[model samples]
Target: MAKRAFDQASQNQPTDEARDAYLEASRAGQSQPPETEAPAAPEVEGQETSEALQKQPTEAEDDQQKLQLEPEKDQTEQQQKLQEETDKEHPEAEGETAAPEEPETEPVDFSILKNGTVNKGGNVVNEDGKAVGRVTEGILKHLIGKKVDEKGNIWSTDGKIVGKAEPVSESERDELLKEPAPFESFPDAVVDKDGFVVSNGEQVGKVIQGDLAILRGKSVDPDGDILDKAGNVVGKAVRWEPEPEPEPEPEVPVDKSILAGKRVNKAGNVVDGSGVIFGRVVEGDVKRMVGRMCDKNGNILSESGDILGKAELVPEGEREGLKEGPFAELEGCTVAKDGTVVTPAGDIVGRVIKGDAKILFGRAVDEDGDILDKNGNVLGKAERWEPEAVERKKNPMSGRKVNREGNVVDEDGNIIGKLTSGDLQKCSGKEIDDDGDVVDYKGNVVGHCSLIEDIPKVEEESPEDKEKREQAEQDKKLAIQMSVCIEQCLDKIRPICKMITEKIDKAERTPEDERDEEALVREVKPLIEEGGRILSEAKGIIKGLDPDGRIAANAKHKSAAREATPEEHHLADVLKDLTGDVTQCIDNAKRKLEDMPHAKKELNPLWGLLNEPLFQILAAVGLLLAGVLNLVGRLLAGLGLGGLVDGLLGTLGISRVLEGLGLGSFTKSLKGGKKKGGGLLGGVLGG
Candidate 1:
């Protein structure tokens, strides 16, 4: 097998020298026939000596001799020695010789391996001069400190064959350089940098260090070839065999009979025949029955086994109502077996009596005992049943009494059978009077009642007193009519005064040359006349109300006015003030209108000339100069040099020059002079 591997590896050799060396090694390995058992010495009568057996060549000595001599001579010498030993040991069988049994050689694939040479230092190096690994196995111990050729053939100092170097590769060299993974069995095994299994720099092998030692400088290829750094085949990777999976335990079938006659309670617990909770069904189709008191037959029942509904009878969303039995049918309300109506919060709201329901609170109830909505409309009703009597009380609003049956009663102690509208009536079918008395057809008081207060009697007045009263009423009527007229006058005066004020303000805001004095007068004249007319009319009405002027005279006297009634004095004073304001507003409007014509005459003709385009351009230039000088003046003022600006303006005499041109105000602003006038042109024209 070693020869076969060498032959295959030689085919891939890069150089002829390497190939020849591989072939020579293969031939050398092939020259030695496998060691076999020496032929048993024939029986010899006189050769019973132990010395001859001891002197006979052992297998190791024979192998060494074969390597030193030619192959044919070695075989011939070995046969002659065996014959001599057989004759000495057993003379009777001297002519008979037993053939040797060939030894078995373990097969190794050398194609995946590379040659490594052993140097004088006892370390192995591959063809690239890189360290492969040291051989420390006892079988190849003689090769230590001996020279090995490129073909891995090891020779002694005398040129005798010993053993071959193990194979190594570049790929294994890289793997050895990695941080070693922890291995429990090879705690002491470590790889050196040169890819040798070492213990503190001393070479080791599998025989001394166990199987883990072989992995120290080797790596398992993907194909499971264990290789050393120099491409030598070291060992094979042991395939990991997983522990067999435990045989699945056979499934124990559920009897399912245990669930017979079971039911799911409102809490989702599965109850058995006696309603004792067995276990809970957490999921699956059975989970839909959670919070539903349903039996296995799908009958939704109460805790007492009353069938309120069936699971299939109601939609899935409405099934929760089954838990409460019949009571859940009524939304927001519930009814007791005794006909006591209650809200879902268990508050008693009404009662069902004799198939008629009555709600004591603000809510209304129908004949079927269901509470009605805000508009007294019933949504649905509960089952009707006769209930026990509930006490009756009088209606609070009417203060009328009620019978034991909750019907209204009149003053005659007659049952009115629940007043549906208005108050109760008499037994005669006549409406009761507001004074709580019942009268006959002729208007005679037939019944004297105390259900409400009695009506008071009114006395008749004397003729003389009536006359004074009528006269006083006539005076009050006249006063109110005069007051109304006064209000109308003031209402008219208000708009006139507002018109005059607005026109005057508009004229004041207008530029003198632009003001239309005639238009202002025309607009204000009518407003002032209207205001004067209103004031005159209002004063006449006031005089008519107080024909002697006594009310006005009394109002002027503060002490006398205090002694008089406040209403009388206050009305007189309001009318007096109204007349005064109307007159003042008229006089002010006339004065303002009268002054407009004169003010219009005083406007400078140059102000009108300023409106011309040439004059406007000159004004713009003057305005620009004013703005620049104004900025300079402000800067000088901020720097505490304001006096300098004043002096500069005085020296320039710009103000005097502008004054001659009717632009004195413009230059004054640049000189930081007092701010006055409507604007640039308004100040120049002195309007």
Candidate 2:
């Protein structure tokens, strides 16, 4: 006795083996059912004995099966008519009928037959319902002991012809499958569960809707070669191949002498080496961008504006003035003594107006306050303190001029007073000669100056003048060092950047345990802090030159960096590459660290499903395979092959397999997964 395990579905449906066994008796040349049937002997230990293994069909499947029968009834009638007409001319169809009409009657119960047979009206199926000849007495006599030939012709084993072959096409397969797609080539084609095609009483080749390649009674597979009943190769199909990927471009080398950097504002725009906006984040979950970002034409950014990157566009029109102008260069320059502004280029452009950041434009001016151009032509009016007033403040002895007679006179030559010995002693211009006598501007002896005649002959300085002179020297040194200060700041950021880059690269290659994320942050933090300190110092040094911070620079950087010296402008780009790169690198390191735990957590459940070492290895391999399939699925989508691939996946049940592997979403995502809020979730999944 054969024992069998029956599941819920199996309990409702008989297996194809049971049905095929019933067909076996008919194929065994049984003419009629025996009077007393013997019980079937089941000796095979592992062999299936029940027909319940065959999946039960729903009402829709039932309709499809009925559909196969409906077409054949009409086809059989047409063929019988054709045979009847042929019989009128040929002896070969002599026995075929253009039979007279008979009274309508109920179906004949072939009580002699044991099990049963699949029938369409009066016709019967020989190839498991993909019939080649009818079961009617007339046709049975002709088909008895016959087999389907290589050409699908029903012929006696002794070589007598019985029936014609049918050609299996797409329509035949569509009829076989329950949920068939719309294709209208065949008008009356039919197929059984065994991949056999039958139209009327003629047998046909196998058909498959999914694989598009038939293996006799085997299931469809598109990538497989077409094989006959004996597994002989009969035909081939051209497999789909995705487009070849383009080779990656090489990276450009940078000059070692200059440290490069960028600044990404809160808006996710990238500033490059020249304060020009290089690119902007246009897409993704960048909802936190501080402001709307635009390009040269004022077009909005379209890329997913990551917090750090370089902008790719240079703006047009007056915007150019923002980037390359004399005033722009003066940004980050140094202030000199004598009220002159010393740019980093080592040129004096103008004087800083007292008590304000205003520049004098260096126009020539008269003592009485008249502005003049280089040609000495009056260009404009200027305001200044009168010479006399300035002189009065400079000296307390502001009154009289002395004549040759040593008499002091006022305006109009009126004699106001006579020069006294004390007045002569107080005279600034009067100096005691080597002979110790007081002399006037004309070397005339003004008086025999009393004691303390040795006035030390040393020029004394005012506190204010001394301070101004010292400030001038400091300014001169600073003007020369502006570039150096900025370069130093960027240099500090560079090593940190390199370390972060190296860390990210290493993380990609090694497992999480092997990653030195802590070391990366440790190395990068101080460098960033130090970079920040250097930037602040550099900005302070250049503040006077860039009062508004468009140029000479600051820690609060933007994309407007420029240099006073045209040749050294690249150096003055203080906020150019450094700021964005430093922050971006730091963020990248942090992101990698953050992502690791989540990735492991998401994958851990899958790992938990496996315990044995072999199973673990298999799980790993499965993940790898899933990764590969996901990649291939993406490539296929890129090539515009969505429908074919999706259909194939469904057919081969690879889609279900992927779902079982926890990559279900990945495989099905191609159809409708475009906009996923395009934000945090998008970034997370993409990463």
Work out the TM-score per prediction.
0.27, 0.16
Per-residue lDDT of 1-687 in model 1, one digit per residue for the tens? 333333222211223444344333332232334232222222222222111011123454432221111222343344344435435666654333233332444443333224455543334666676556433211223444565554445556887655444343344444433344423233344444444443444444222222554565554444444567898766544333336699999987534444445567665555655656544544444445544455554454556776544432223344333244343344455445545666666666545443433333334344445556677776445543334568765432243433334354657766543423333343244333444444456665444334222223457899978975674454445445654765676677667767766887788778877888877756665665555555555545544555664443432332311222333333344444443444344344445545466533433221121122212222322232212222322333444433332332233344554565445544656344324422322232121
Per-model clash counts, in order, read 14, 29
lDDT of 2 at 64: 25
On the 0 to 100 scale, the lDDT of residue 214 in model 2 is 36
Q: Write the per-residue lDDT of candidate 2 for residues 1-687, one digit (tens) a residue.
A: 011211211121223453334233222222222122222121222222122222223453333211011122333343344434444456643333224333343332332222223232222234445422222111332344444433333455566544332222223223333343222222343443555444453443344333333333442223334455676655432322235698887866423211123334454554544645554454444454334444343233334743322233334442233343334433434444454555556565544444322333444434433344567865444332212333223221133344456544446666544444645434434555443345667878665432223324458989978975674454345434554655675676577567546855676677667766555545544544554454455444444443452322221131112212332233323333443344345435545655566443333232111111211121222232122222323333444433432332333344444445344545545223324422211211121
Query: Once superposed on the true structure, which residue ranges of model 1 sit more than 4 Å away at CA?
Result: 1-487, 502-523, 539-687
lDDT of 1 at 437: 42
Candidate 1 versus the native: TM-score? 0.27
Distance from true position, residue 650, model 2, in Å?
A: 46
Model 1 weakest 10-residue run by lDDT: 46-55
